[model samples]
Target chain A: MTLNASRQRLLGPDSLKPLNEGFEVIGAFNPGAVRVDKETVLLVRVAEKPLAVRSGFVGLPRVVSGGSVSVDWTPEVELDLRDKRVVRRKADGIARLTSLSHLRVFRRREGGSGWTPGPALLPETSAEEYGIEDPRITTIDGLHWITYVAVSRHGAATALASTTDFVAFERHGVIFPPENKDVVLFPRMIEGMHVALHRPTTRTDFCRPEIWLARSPDLLHWGQHQPILCGLNPWESERVGAGPPPIQVDEGWLVIYHGCGPSQGSEEVGAYCAGAALLDLNDPTRIVSRSVQPTMRPAVEFERNGFVPNVVFPTGLIDHGARLSVYYGAADTAVGLADLSRDELLSSLN
Target chain B: MTLNASRQRLLGPDSLKPLNEGFEVIGAFNPGAVRVDKETVLLVRVAEKPLAVRSGFVGLPRVVSGGSVSVDWTPEVELDLRDKRVVRRKADGIARLTSLSHLRVFRRREGGSGWTPGPALLPETSAEEYGIEDPRITTIDGLHWITYVAVSRHGAATALASTTDFVAFERHGVIFPPENKDVVLFPRMIEGMHVALHRPTTRTDFCRPEIWLARSPDLLHWGQHQPILCGLNPWESERVGAGPPPIQVDEGWLVIYHGCGPSQGSEEVGAYCAGAALLDLNDPTRIVSRSVQPTMRPAVEFERNGFVPNVVFPTGLIDHGARLSVYYGAADTAVGLADLSRDELLSSLN
Candidate 1:
């Protein structure tokens, strides 16, 4: 098994106490983490929904202007409300959610084992009308930079935000166009150029949601995009995306990623699994080895039930010199941790 | 017995399933009601507590200001947090709460069997700094006049609000000062003056929280205060309070109220039971006859277990000619109902 049961910390939505007295932290997962000095600063994506009374129907609380809240509701029969973590609205043929998303940063100091919350980052621009989500952090030249998916009616686009203290942030506008997401910037410059791994969509392409490599002279402008990886194995026949920043090794660059199987059974609809691929040190375009099968798949109950069930999407990775800590969202309900030996993963890079 | 156990409807906070979606409606009891045309409109006091991840301690959500909330937590070692509904700071001292209460109105049309939720009424005014709870509705000539307890740090005071459509409300300022609660206005004015049944506090009085009567000409200015009844039997050795608006009957004004025993055991601390009494038609201050014992007590699991265990506080009643539907808060969790013959209760009154 690529991931083991030993030394795992599954931080569920319950892990986050009430944001304040009235607001609840429903989903505290899909976090972006970086080791900052004596702490692991986690840019946790926390989804907060308003509190309301429920009878035959439910009243959903929504934020109004001027710091006020208003409630809206739908009868149990009128709406097919199934999951507690999701707010779904049926359109055309697919179900969509009406609720917005925001991110809350948490700092877990080395000595203090628990996560302490910080101020919330909300969707401010029209590009982020649907709210920003699922950030991936890369610390370059001491400053921690976050690349997240900005969603709106236009589609999903990559946006950048940088912070040193995690309290204050500098916005760097949308880095990619619509119908694109799962973007991650390399921790350091490669061959004197900034490199980023992202998944781009092509309507007619058989292999959809494939990971690609792009080089940029500056962090903003990009060019020479090459399709680096596609869904190959049966476990990854549906979609594949880069997970965390590639870890540098003597052999090459160790890249961890997530993939899903073909949509067949209920468990396979969106079941996520983790895998690793090794890329050449000098030229990332050259692939050395790739895992033939998923290194890790959903196993525990926490990974089997959530807003989206049967999933384990790893996003945050920290090298503790001896062991590697993988921080991932368990079933899209909570932040989970799985530890692996650094030496073992390096030897089994394929 | 004054009450029968046939064909019951008990609603606790758990009955509110939507609130059960992402949050927990710890208590949905102590409701007030009035028959509006073919609909039975109920104003339910719902106490929602945010779900927090529990380890060594859990943070309790509390309302702050500007429609925002905050949390104050105590470690499990320092504070005794046994009850899922309540949070107590100390073991021996008066128990403190970590939740905020809000009121939700539900309209159950005569033809409709279940309660359909309406808009939620939030704590807006300064008088309702903490919350507005356990309302009693009196339909005078046309409009439904609601009198409820406004709780804050200052004290629990009596406040008034009138609604004609149940959609719009006209707030009438605080009618009674702090350290007072359980205010219910009479349906019809007697002696060309408005009469109200209330519960007043007297520190030196052995029978604390006794029912009292007051006369008002304008409904705002009250006078001629007189204690109507007090705790009598061992089942009600602690305190008693007026329930819903007294029903007008031929024998006299029939009143079904709640009482509690001495809070010596854990089960009895907040244990509430229902009782009945008859008062003079013209002079409500004079109790014609009162129940020698409790008419109804916590029996079902829903009534005996909740945020406050063993609590059955009756606050709403609907006359259906053949049978009286006594709607009550069960175990301080959900709404409950019990059917009893009108004639039986009148004859059983001692």
Candidate 2:
């Protein structure tokens, strides 16, 4: 427990711009990258296009079931991926799904037709069959939130929309739904409310999926779920995420995560580096000092070298006062950089 | 959650008699059965009398220096026993020198030669090196409690010793010391304080080995803890225990435990049923309902026959308004009987 170092990059992913509005941009992979005002935003992973091709797959978005609902896809259904239990069964098998139907999100905007994809906010909830994916962002008193993950047919949750400018979005349906995801949220209002960082998982066998901590006051319900870190051991025995939007430092609030190795479900190989903990800025679920190791990993070669390899995730972090940067995302196709200082990643957490 | 049957049998295994007065009484063999009033206790699993004889093998307990605390009792230590981290580092390296040696506790009082085995609660400190063994007893309001599992060299804790009558015991020293054991206590006092049922064994690997829950504003300083009961599926995927001494009725707090299947460690087998859950007598960590099976199993033949076959092990229970008797102990050797009707075990937990 002693993290302080900082520095990694891809922040303005590449000269900014992009949101030319043609719709369909990309790379919000596990984004959530926040920094706001001084710039370093990005919730961008967008994926929208479809004016002709109907059979080869069009745009997908029609869902309208009754109870366990989740059927959105205009491509006229051809997707099945062998139904792992038709969205965890119950009340009939209800097909018409899609799961990895091509994720979304996009936002570099400055006035152009190069990015613009956004909205689809909780679109047909149930996991979109598999479309929503990573977002992050932060802000508080002036609005702007994000959080993302969504998936569908009926599983994977996270979500939480909001927006005061990026064009318009209000959603909020799932604040921390289902088996949970990497959620971040903790930019401000520590004692006045809103604090996040969740994980959830456990089907039992004495637990394994760790990292919890809720509280909300009004960012849409949420109350003290608690728990906070317990995942098996040795640098997070298999799962551990949430890497950007947390910072604040002087002595508390840190965060910076990503600790894999041993996962077989969401495809986790390892190393995206960085680790930290220090919470308690008025009970951010206490903690106060963590980081058994990892202050910035993936060395370089665009963070190690396509759709998935060594990896370098990040998402966003800017710092300023002592220069910290960190905006990753490399093996999922482009965007990478790095830097240091900020007490060398909180002195490698002890 | 309905439980209310009654009859009576608070302790057997011959209900405390041994006072042989010298120290060699035998019998103690896994008496984790619980209960506390009119008396029906027996945490008996005794196996004392062995200190040193390595080569010619007399009492087994070698591993002196650098060999790390000792206790190999070699047969190649049961042929490697599936390397559970070297069987938990050889059970914490022979419990740091047999938790300090020399001990005694053998009751069976009536007159004198009829049974003699007391006088040795010795060890003013150093956790009796390796003394305390199977005790399980509970009483609540009027006092009379005991939890045993103590050892030494710093390992295997869960030791609370109390007594208003059985003769002497008042020690309270290691109340849940090392790595933990099957504690059990919840005979009364749910909202007023005192509620135990421990089982700590998390040698890492991200948590497994559970069954936690503390609460004791005074029973001697326990706090909230909470885990309740995990290690789910397949009649307990191996390891789970807390059977005897939790029965309340009027809907909730039944307990009856003992689960262990995939063995090699002490040659595992199964049997011995009776599951129940429904706490919150004022927030005993909530719960409210559980027990999808097992209300009394191991059918017949003194409960499936002896030294460790099937195994029954209840410890004690009484109720007696008309039904609910349950004294149990069968496989570790004698003392059985079974009755039903506390509404037929709360209608088999619905």
Candidate 3:
């Protein structure tokens, strides 16, 4: 615990009720940002769906002609049942793993949170036949733009949409296409173009996922793929992705990203946290400084237990000079807030 | 499934073994390097100790005060009961966990194939109160050095040792005083100094476990701390630690590390896997590439089960030109092999 900060339940369990009912309001892992009416807001990727059934797994249970159940052989997908190398899910389905069909958002209204729920953003494309997840919202000039993961059989692809207010969003179609997520745009104009951070997933032996800097004159079409950050280090030796929008720190542009490590057991997916890296304000890809550790984690029950556990996603950040407030989703269930000083975050990175 | 090129073994109850002698072998995570002969090897951190009686645990049972065998709330520590985490024989004082008694060689002699046994290194060390576990071996010039997690009641610390042969070893004083593991040395010397990767656990508002780079002229003394990688990704955002010895590629040096994501109910940890990163050969601290998905995971039964299951630790890597023969310990039990071509590993990092 190098970070000795007090924990506060800024948004406790069931704080954003009614609107958040029947669904989990979790941080989108990578939160997107957009500015409208002079106030900064977040496009939080909130996942909400029905619980799934797992009893019908291949080897866990043998179904007879009459629908009787008996143990025969173990299932291949049930990799967690036999070994401790992977995380195992409850076959009964009583235990909630994650589902696809749903996603929503949480906006900061009137400079404060816990306001009346705004408009709900749902998936509108076929690529997200399963559902859309992990939205990264960025605004250019007056137009609000969002890039999200559209999930279907083809896997997760990046899609784009725009909105002026929390309500009335105009679909901008799929911006980056499939196998991509974690898209964040730089505020203002860079060389008279929109610069965004995007990670495209490709199939390779090493599974290398890197953050690329892309520029777009219009919010829809992106060009000039420049490498911003690569996932090749001891801390994030495996996979690296982005989180939230890059905050304007004095030294440079501070962007929070996510890095991955290996798992310990069957079917168990590891956790995600917040890490910060400073990019050149003008270039937006050059590295200045980065946090060596995460800003937050899934330590509480709501964070450690749920459909998918050990997950603290930072979908948005609000910088208030000395204080920085971060709104994140926990355990794929509810939204939570964690605050720290700008000085504290910068000092801790060293 | 891309690694289906190697020999695959389930090695469950169906496979032959020293019956009832099954156990788990977790990665000390990132182990220290020890150069022996013309080869570089990793001193893997292994924790195989005899099981202790569970008398006070919440879910465990105990004997009653009466002579009869009744469920008791509180029992003696000396009494042996069902302990899931430890692998020991209560009847005899012998234990499998690191005792200053043994060290298994990653490179064994002939006839050392499937279900074969190899000789241990030095059976004893003056500094090892509980023996060495999870060793990270590195080679600088011709000298081979190993930094490992040495444990005693005083708490765990990183200890350095030098070895030229798989049989003999020379102990260097503790490189890191205490509360440290996941140490990897840069393959090449940087600025006439030895660069190493390490993580010192500290308590922060969020659990701050990060990978750091340190410089040392002498392998034992470390200075010039630089923050290289951060665990801010969604997959491994919880706590990121180092994994295997770094592999040198054309683009950069590749280091595989382990990360713990969000936890599940009743379980504080989740899945562990092998993730790769490319770093500057000269700087050693600058990251070049990273992976978004895991290269090797707990996909098989042996890789998924065991003492404290769900762990796949790759401590030894033998590069045979086109293929990388990765010898890994599955679920802390036995050794298994997987192969990935140099092309695949490099391409995945893109």
Choose the strongest candidate by TM-score: 1
lDDT of 3 by residue, B1-350 (tens): 12343535422222322111222222322223333444434344344332333445312211123311112222335334333442233443222222121345543333334332233443233334444666656666666667666543223456777766546777765565334567767666767877778765431111235676766665655544444666655556655667656777767777767665555565535666666678887777777877677677677776676644666666556556677766555665545666777678767774
| Fnat of all models, as shown | 0.00, 0.00, 0.00
By lDDT, the candidates rank as: 1, 3, 2
TM-score of each: 0.47, 0.27, 0.43
- Each model's TM-score for chain A is 0.87, 0.29, 0.77
Query: In Å, what is the interface RMSD of model 3?
Result: 20.7
Best by DockQ: 2
Considering the two chains of model 1, state its CAPRI-style docking category: incorrect
Q: Give the alpha carbon lDDT tens digit for every residue of B146-263 in model 2.
A: 7766554334455577776555778766544345567788877766666787765532212245566665645554534445675454454455667556767666676666555454
lDDT of 3 by residue, A145-185 (tens): 67677653333546777777767877665555334577777
For each candidate, report its DockQ versus the true two-chain complex: 0.01, 0.02, 0.01
Error of 2 at A349 (Å): 27
How high is the lDDT of residue A325 in model 3?
A: 68
lDDT tens digits by residue: candidate 2, A25-100: 3233445545445434556443332223445453443334432223233432343323221221122223332223
Q: Write the per-residue lDDT of candidate 1 for residues A1-350, one digit (tens) a residue.
A: 36553535456667666543455666777888799889887777766565554676654543445434345665555544554433344321112233446788888888787888787777776556556788899989888889887764334557888988888888877665434567888877888888888775432222345777766666764444556787778888777888887878777888888998865564325689888888889888778988777777888877877767878888888878677788887777788887877666666655
Stretches of model 3 off by over 4 angstroms after superposition = A1-42, A51-98, A105-115, A232-235, A265-267, B1-350
